[model samples]
Target: MPEMLIDYYKAIENSSAKMLEAARLKDWDEVVRCEGACAVLIEQLRYQSQQQELEPAQRKEKARIMQRILRNDAQIRVLAEPWLTQFEHLFEGQLQVMH
Candidate 1:
């Protein structure tokens, strides 16, 4: 069978879930990997959307999936904030050392 637009939404949601899980585990590398997957999926989705569109029911499901993805992304940001801050500080130190 051919692929569907809803399937892309589901795959993106799944990737976001994985990203949240990896973030919770403090595995930033895995989170980054999942993020890359999400990015590729998003691009694929954009391309596929031009060719296919969801039915009314599928559109509803897509909305719900998007909500969940947003939730997962919010949680991931919350989990990664401290680490990002520290990473920024590390870069700052490097810049200082270079000067």
Candidate 2:
């Protein structure tokens, strides 16, 4: 596989680990944040894969796609914290009731 592909996969793996850890700790916020980060990374990888077939003349178009991917990733990361926090609270409440 290409170096880019490897790197992308590594990012996803790392993000998944983090998310799992957060879930184990019942840290809903962290889990959500990590998951969001993973999602963005995956989307970026998807975009990059699509650009791999483009011709040299389409460099600008590829750049635009990359830019959009990056922007979406950033946006997701920004919202991750709050979403995770909310998720954690809900999860905790449910767990408490189960006891």
Candidate 3:
């Protein structure tokens, strides 16, 4: 059971890593695709979590995996900031023309 939980976390970490790579490459579409995959994994993890508990050692490992996932997410957000700003500007311009 603990191993299964760890596997889920590992899969999420892999998805996050892929997302980070896509961000680094400036491939927003690929990043979004990986984000969707991560979301599904997260949902599955949530359901599995309610049905099982991790042992102490596995808990520590899970914490480490979560930390890496968070770091990847943070970097992805940073990479996205400029693109988001540009998208917002485009929307603002459209709004002004429509008014």
> Per-residue lDDT tens digits of candidate 2, residues 23-52?
556676887788789889888878877765
Ordered list by TM-score, greatest first: 1, 3, 2
Count of clashing pairs, candidate 2 = 2
Global Cα lDDT for candidate 1: 0.93
Which portions of model 2 show Cα errors greater than 4 Å? Answer: 1-3, 53-99
Q: Backbone collision count in every prediction?
A: 0, 2, 0
State the C-alpha lDDT per candidate. 0.93, 0.66, 0.93
Write one digit per residue (lDDT tens) for candidate 1, span 1-99: 128889999999999999999999999999999999988998999999999979999989999999999999999999999999999998997899899
Give the range where candidate 1 is weakest over 10 consecutive residues by summed lDDT.
Answer: 1-10
Question: Where is model 3 more than 4 Å wrong at Cα?
Answer: 1-3, 96-99
Query: Where's the lowest-lDDT run of ten residues in candidate 3?
Result: 1-10
Residue 34, candidate 3: C-alpha displacement in angstroms: 0.4
